[model samples]
Target: MKIEVNVKKRYFFALLGILLVLGGVFAVYAYNSNPPNPRVFGHTINEVDGITCNSGQAVTRTAAGWSCVNIASSGGSTPVNPVNTLSYFEDFIDRGDTSEVNHPGIISFQGYAGKTFGYIHSKDMFDITFLVKGNGTLYGLSSYESFYVGLVDASVSSRIYFFISGGNWQAGTRNGGSTKVTNLNTGVSIGNSPEWFKLRIKRVDAGTIEFFINDASVGTINSNVPVMPMQIFAATPGEADGRLHVLIDYIDLKITNLAR
Candidate 1:
């Protein structure tokens, strides 16, 4: 009886030892599976602090540090490359000019003071078109009494333009305080006739400009192209006699390529 009791007690202690070993192994596994600073998606939880991702951006860790990267939109659509093309058209229906007269698809400027209408742009590639005409005499007037259309810098010092003065039309460019002028010489005098004509200026490549009138190529300028940002403008200098009446049907501009 004594020998059987001792054997039973030894069996009970062995079973307890086996249970204790298994419990210790399970505890070690639990700690390894769920660490204090666990990794999520290959990044530690502490690494994502203070990182803000805006719309269309994702948080990423790089060798340089954490950054917000621009990603494709969330709609599962493929990302598209940016195309640099811009267009603007104004028909003069409501141009917000107090002195302008809005006549069916036309705007007339007839004031004694100088007037200017324009848009500013930094692009070097562009196409500008406008339809313009004069109502009164265009010759034998003061030198200041002229109309101009083209591009000009903010200081009005450098420009490339189509100029109408004293019954003649010319292509003119001013750079670095020096001026170069070329007459279109279309052989048609534009004196006082209320005839409308289209003028187009195009810059297809660097350092070259093309001029057209009524869809006919008039001239090409290869030198003195304004390198700075310019404003596409239509302007008339102040006339003391107040005879500078100009009408414009529309003005349009297209920026073709802006990759540079």
Candidate 2:
């Protein structure tokens, strides 16, 4: 009888230990399956209920954790791939130009015939867009008079620029102070009046540059594209007839795939 009692006591302890191990496994499973609110010092901590995402992104939960994702539109549009981009925009409503013209929605640059007026100095190369128009017509003065809008390097020698000279629209680029210029004369004449023209310059790749006017593709330059960092510049080199001024509606720069 003493032996049997000792054996029974051992069985009881063994059964208790087995139950404890099973309970621990079940607790771990439960925690992983539906994790309870995190606790600290015996107090339940508040968890973030929602997260904010950028323009084309949404918050979602994956197996590992919560993260941001690009979401599709409700209209069944294709999902846009996410890209890292830096952008800058100026409408000139609150900013003043060298002319100090306190207009409601425009910035004016009025200067002498030989001088250049620049607005924004960007840190690097960017896809640029601007709305601009000159004050008067100085056609047939291509050699001496022009209005320039686009990217230019610090020395003003290397650039990818769009210019209207002698009422003709042209896209040109110069590399490393080389006098040889790659020009695309669009043959489309632009009048120097109050009407604004939308001009865009986009760097397609390391070797290509695209130009657009009023949302139409005018030309592309495959060579002579400046590789150096450039600034957004607009200059009105006045004609011999009178002082030239430029009125700008806005300027926007979108930078992607920055150089390392």
Candidate 3:
């Protein structure tokens, strides 16, 4: 009887030990399967504009949170190139002549307000198709305060001005005393943004020109226009208190079949 009782005690002790070992293993497995958030543990997740930033994006911490920036697509160091066949291109890096002028101050190549850009005044014009990429702010004035980029006739009285005013676009032409204008509603969308844009203006025909914003056609004008000898200008004329700032990345002029 004593031996049987001792055997029963031994068996009971062995089973209890095995059960304890199994419970410990199960506890460890459960912990490994459901852990805390990796961000909480590693603390590497970046916050952008109160939102979490994904991997491989550059970010700057703002007053509220972080801001994701396009370090790759935003700024430019190389000269702008033509997408299609071209006859002329100006990267705005080097002005080949002194014909360029800045009335209030000297023109800059280092860029304006930390934007990498330049400006120019071309003496001659090629059959025109070019992309003008930049941004500026234009204010209203009573007098003739024109901030424009486009073809200007020799007399200056006849002009096709692709200008911005009152946060709107003006595709305007003045021939002698007669004037015509087309207003585009893209100003509020384009104004005051740090992002670069592609403003393409092309001569569609002898009597017509088309204007585009980021490859989208804003408008087309049909009017009697001058020939190709028009001066390619970036100008702020008859300045008053009205302010105009245009920062250009490049102007790639191409001679397409339409130009020919």
Candidate 4:
């Protein structure tokens, strides 16, 4: 028998490449401290946690803790890992209680009646995306108990004017001649861009209501909604699907205007 020894350079090169990639990823994380959101384009017209944003969005919490943190995954679709899912915002009064988990997505304000959230998913650096199905009500501009939208009946209803809904969502059946236009845009599923699907209510008002997904608008209700809401919620008026999923990254409510 003869002794033979073989050395492969490719293996060494592959290991070196992996290390460099990891180093680059770490560097990017260390340098960028900003989060993905709607105003990444320019300026927005809303407030997060008592502060108005001239551009971009901000997320925070009260006496408890803040949810929605950065995570890495494989299925993430954008600037983040495609599989990353880390928007778990919650506030439990007691450490051993899980009751507060129900309203973790809801934010409370002190003086103002409006709320906002900044979120993202694996798509283009966003980590979390909001989703909704069937007839559900979401309040953005106005969170008072008296405000809300009608239903999710997409049809030839003449009253279904873009400006008529005033940025609110009306969920119902167009087959019937019944629709709840409400007095303003309260309970409407909202997103930021038309690309946004299954979303969260942005701002519901009697003059202008907006909805967003991944912090972008997908639909608008821009009529009669002039009311500004401080509280936001999701309600189901019909059992078309019988369930609603208000997937949110964080909820910011303004009890007082810290910016003003």
**lDDT (Cα, tens digit) per residue for candidate 2, span 57-167:** 433345665454443221122222211211122231112222222211223344321122233323333566766655444433243345676777767787788876556
Candidate 2: residue 221 Cα off by (Å): 0.2
Local accuracy of candidate 4 as per-residue lDDT tens digits, 78-126: 1121111222322211122222222333221222111222211101211
Native-structure RMSD, model 2: 20.4
Model 3 residue 167 distance off true place after TM-score fit, in angstroms: 1.2
How much lDDT does candidate 2 score? 0.53
Q: What is the C-alpha RMSD of each candidate to the true structure, in Å?
A: 26.6, 20.4, 21.9, 19.4
Which residue window of length 10 is worst by lDDT in model 2? Answer: 39-48
Q: How do the residues 44-146 of candidate 1 rate in per-residue lDDT, one tens digit apiece?
A: 2244433434323444456787675543332122221111111122332123433212212233343332223444343456776767655445532123335
> What local distance difference test score does each model get?
0.53, 0.53, 0.41, 0.29
Candidate 1 TM-score, true structure as reference: 0.51
Query: What TM-score, computed on C-alpha atoms, does each candidate reach?
Result: 0.51, 0.51, 0.42, 0.24
Ranking by lDDT: 1, 2, 3, 4
Residue range 1-260, candidate 3, lDDT tens digits: 99999999999999999999999999999877633321111012121112322211233434654454322211233211211211122332332422222111111111112221222222222223233322223433112234456666555555665666665555666554355433344442544443334555666655676777666787876664544334555553332221332333233444321221
Clashing pairs in 1: none
Measured on C-alpha atoms, candidate 4 has an lDDT of 0.29
Candidate 2 local lDDT, residue 196: 57
Q: After superposition, how far is residue 210 of candidate 1 from its true place, in Å?
A: 0.3
